[model samples]
Target: MKKALPATHTSMMRYAVLSISLIITTGPAVSSALPLMAKNFPNISLAMIDMIATVQQFTIMIFLLISGSIAKKIGIKPTISIGLIITGVAGIFPVFSQSFVAIFISRLLLGVGIGLFNSLAITVIDLLFTGNDKAQMLGNRSAMEQLGVCILNLVVGLLLLINWHMAFLIYALAFPIMIFFWRYVPEPRVNKESKETHQKINMPVVWLALLLFFLVMCSTAIIVQIPNIIVRGSLGSATTASLIISLNTLAGMAMGFLFGRIYKVVSDMTLPIGTFLMAMGAILIGMGGNLYIVSLGTILCGFSYPLAGTYAFNLLSKIAPQGSETLGNSVLLIGCNLGSFISPIGVRILAKISGNAFIGMFIVLLVVTGGILVFQWASKHVSKMKKV
Candidate 1:
């Protein structure tokens, strides 16, 4: 007759810890692998190159609905465990890959893994916490993700100096994350009536979710492409690009910590302010030539992410039935994938018109800024309505 551990206890700790590992295991490796992957799979058409980045997001987007359902039906722990195993297996692929197809397929599998983990992790958090506790957990998850980017990107950059293959070694870090789930993380309590009572996702929530997805896509676009754009545009080498990217990570890490501190005072309005900061960052990155300006943009954008994510999570909690954050994550992952999928084509279009990829990236930033503002408005209006 042992009582269940409170959601505030085990579940929150589990998500915060896993969130760090998820980002560490995935984010930097993807960034580090890009240049090396291009070299290894030469003759990869731009279209195909775009697919490599986009495929993961696409798979996550497609599989998320199913993954969410599966998590509800089976268990969050199993879904998370399966995702880690898939990502781990996919990680070992680079060692064997010499062809475009091998790399391409591997990235898709990685997406499947990401989709599972992303969907389940959010759901687990949603199930475990309520009210402000939920908000803080989401905030911490955001911080952990930024931490992952900071630590992994820096490590990958240093490792890249050794050999590009060494970059893939980052995946090995995830092996321990699986063990962590088994040891400390307990199964998220499932709501028995949720399946029977939950309506089809509300229409308003769907629209907001889609818009949120687009914002995430924009963020991912910046994260995946910005470093290469800088290296190619101004810095002129992978090593230098790594330094610039590391600065971006440092900025994000600092902002993540700041958000963890300020989340209370900033409260819900953090979304608009965050979007404003992100817009400023994008403008600086797009328009400025001074490396310092670019660094400033990176920090501003980094801070914006957690702010936006926390705001979105709060909005989502209101719209979704019980355990909606998992669904919310699926939406977010899809947006990220769509952004990755769209970037190459967008670049192609920009390249044709402007004759340079960096300028194209700048243009993309402008477009993303417009989209971010639109969502900020929508989210705020939605929040006001909820209050009324």
Candidate 2:
């Protein structure tokens, strides 16, 4: 049954479904421990060791495109299970490996595993729920990934005390998540390909993907430049930086839990509101050198991302054709990962142009965020005029 308005899910199955997301975002976070890793692997070059954190992105993008076909052939349940098993096993392989090559391969396999299940995580929500229920769950899904990133990042700090390798053990959480998911979440009925076979994806999905790509790029700029903002601005110490990030993630979690209500109240205005808030944050951090002010800006940026992300995915579920939402999501994720991959270069360009990294980046971010609203307003206005 399509869940009605103001929807909520309280079942054990709900948690089981959300568990996969917790581990999905855990991969990129290994970058946080790179300094410690560099110390431990003295024989390996820093650039090569750094690649361990990113090598998965290529495999992940590859698998994201193909997993839809794989799901169509094998069915979603088995595909999800296979992905989970791969994630759990490959995620921890680094714990046993001292060789950079082996750990790099492990990270590659980890990306492959994540790509297999990444779109399906969103697809499963559409398959199992509907309407506000789906919207709410999508919000929670983003929250789950953010939560994983935050918590596991903290855990990685602690685990490094035990062994440099022990930090990799954090991925073991995926095993239990898989077991519960397999036992509780039933296999959803797969939609047979009919129109989806003949239909090329419509232009709106592509535009949305491009929009997502831009938003992700802007979002990555926020993280990339934060340290420079802290050190250059001399806002505070590393401890202060960590706290600021905590505030950011906590705000995101709160916003995500409340997204359903926000959407119900604002309807289509949700996107503009989110983008505005994000731009506001960028402006604050760019201009506000005060420690507390920067922290507030950080929180606002954090809050806006999941708010915008959930809305985008919810719209995708509506606009994408039946049996093809997964592929549409694939394109979106590709744009998303591509944005992250290229963000540093973008940051460098901004730094060179403005002669200041933090303020210059946010200045451009503010302008780009405004462009999103302009484009949205123009599109809606034209659509209304056509109907009239």
Candidate 3:
């Protein structure tokens, strides 16, 4: 019938899963608090305002290529632990300050911390687990991260209704959990040569990473744009828009719980299925004329996001060289940040030209889905090769 996955698989996986989840929760807390942040710090320009998303991505993109090397030289545990400490401290700094310079410094430090964490976290999953275990581990990892973002965003939104500074406090909440993870999570096993050489970047991996970059760009655009689009487009009131966004979060949390279990049954169908659903969801959100339609689309969008995200990571792990765990994970961070970095500007420019964010987002989603399909084909063909 079926073989069993290892106990270490379940246990060690939790450490990365939990830490990444915390990291996601922290950043989105800022996003959810944007209006309040702007009110408190009025000098925040549209260009500087956009930096809320862009700075983090810019830092992650710049550091991702180097993080793999750092993880190899230092060790994943130390890298991640140090990142958490820095991230926690930087994240907490903004809660007390209204100075734009101080706030910007905090955001910059937060970005660096995330860069470190993102680089090591996914790669550690590749190192700690293998085969079917790897697939499931990645799925579970994606779920935890997605769930954290969705849930924490909701919490931040709720807390923002109370006070903006309260939302920043949420970043501190992660530190205790990370401390526990540091104590419990075992160090990864890397060979001396793998650590020394830093393995050549595979051409196929780079190609696939570019494809993932496009996919994530569309996803981040939707995630950031949906609430405002709904409110401004007259599809719903602010409260209704927030609730719809929260439903999207719930969908992600549900998908995270089910992703690995579903993968066991669907196998290779997962990525294609997820991409298709996600594309359909994005289109639904774009074309939707009312809140009901938008809400339905969001639920579908949520399900599709983490499913595809997890599949992307699983594919990266499969193709990555031995001891290239950090590198593989770095690719994911790079792809995701590249997507985030481009989305707001693209959406803003498109909105300026087209006169509607919905239409712009719709066009972008179609292009993104097309990219994912191309990568899906490439990855399948790559899977067929005896050597990557």
Candidate 4:
């Protein structure tokens, strides 16, 4: 029989695996550099230039539904390693080529790399830890992911001052992360019984995934509309809007770090609480006239968005049958990606109908989130009554 690693070693390995979150930074890191890229490729339409950032999202969505199945056959460690390598290579390919077509293709492939292993960060936590440990690890993973995004965005912005190509080097961070993963993370052991148990999907997982989809949809609208909201409200300029958005990211990082402790106190009510916070934030942003109030609203939404997402993932991990954490995560991933993609369009349609985009999104969020919270409360109350 093989000897088990020390608890300390196991914990270190878990953190190392969480570093895979860096792969998600690739797309967002380039977002700040898009104007520079447009100047470089003046011949390309602005829409096409924007596609360079968004094309990755489409590929990520396509692969998220299947990456879990692929991991089942190849094993998680290898799957994640391959993903990092693919992302690193694709991310750098744009540096060597100035062709719009070439860079677009490279970004699309980078999405594939991210899609391959994004959910594994969560799945690995489910595999390695249990109970509060598992919950804490999940929270840590979210925090690490937001931290990666924050750092990469800052790095890319600074690098863009030197040369647009230099910003692409941020993807190189994946190489060291891959090394850490291979050296510290061990393969999970899955028995035949556990494998069989995870193969069948649960109805609750489907419902939760849909809930996540709607939540993400509403949450993302806050990001998409912030600039417009600020300019229209005369709360700030474009620079001020960006700064507020960065603050929102910081708020998310902080909330993710605190999620484990918060979850302990709120237990199953975490999701409802998150929804309520988001609704309050949306209302503030919709109605506020001052910068401070809007910034506070942004922070609240940012905090609640990731908190709800973390709670959903933790719940899914518990309900997942053994080896099926990846599959369950993938389902949730689909919901999240679909919601993100639809948010801008959904908000636009609602705004058209309401004749005020900002207020329209706020109304949508309040109604939807309020309804979900009520449903959750009623469900819990009924369950308790039945137990009595």
My TM-score estimates for the predictions, one after another, are 0.76, 0.91, 0.83, 0.91
Per-residue C-alpha lDDT of model 2 across residues 1-388, encoded as one tens digit per residue: 9665321244777878888899886777777678888998899898987887788888999999988888877888788889988988998998888887888888899999999999889888878888787888888888888888888998988998887788888888878988988887877765566324733467878877876776677677777667667777788887678678778878888888889889888878788788778877877887767988888888898899878878988999778865688898888889889888888886678669987555665666567667777887898999999999
Q: Indicate the residue-level lDDT of 185 in model 3.
A: 75
**Residue range with the least summed lDDT across 10 consecutive positions in model 3:** 16-25
Candidate 1 structure quality by residue, lDDT tens digits, 1-388: 9998754486646554445344422533456457666776578765576455446765667677678777776778887888888877786576556667777788788777776787566666677766766676666666667677666766777877877666756666666777766566777766667655543466656666655654555465566666666676674466656666566666655665565456678665666666666667766766656667766776677667667656676567677656455666666555545655566565566568867544554555456557656866887899999999
Off by over 4 Å in 3: 1-17, 32-34, 37-54, 154-163, 348-388
Measured with C-alpha atoms, the lDDT of residue 53 in candidate 3 is 39
Model 1 C-alpha lDDT versus the unseen true structure = 0.64
**Which candidate's lDDT is highest?**
4
> How far is 303's C-alpha from truth in model 4 (Å)?
1.1
TM-score winner: 4
What is the TM-score (0 to 1) of candidate 3? 0.83
The order by descending lDDT is 4, 2, 3, 1
> Cα lDDT of all candidates, in order?
0.64, 0.81, 0.71, 0.82
Between candidates 1 and 4, the one scoring higher on TM-score is: 4
Q: Write the per-residue lDDT of candidate 4 for residues 247-289, one digit (tens) a residue.
A: 8888988998898899999887788788778877887787778
CA RMSD of all predictions: 5.2, 3.2, 4.2, 3.0
Off by over 4 Å in 1: 1-21, 24-54, 96-103, 154-166, 220-241, 286-289, 322-325, 344-388
Better of 1 and 2 by TM-score: 2
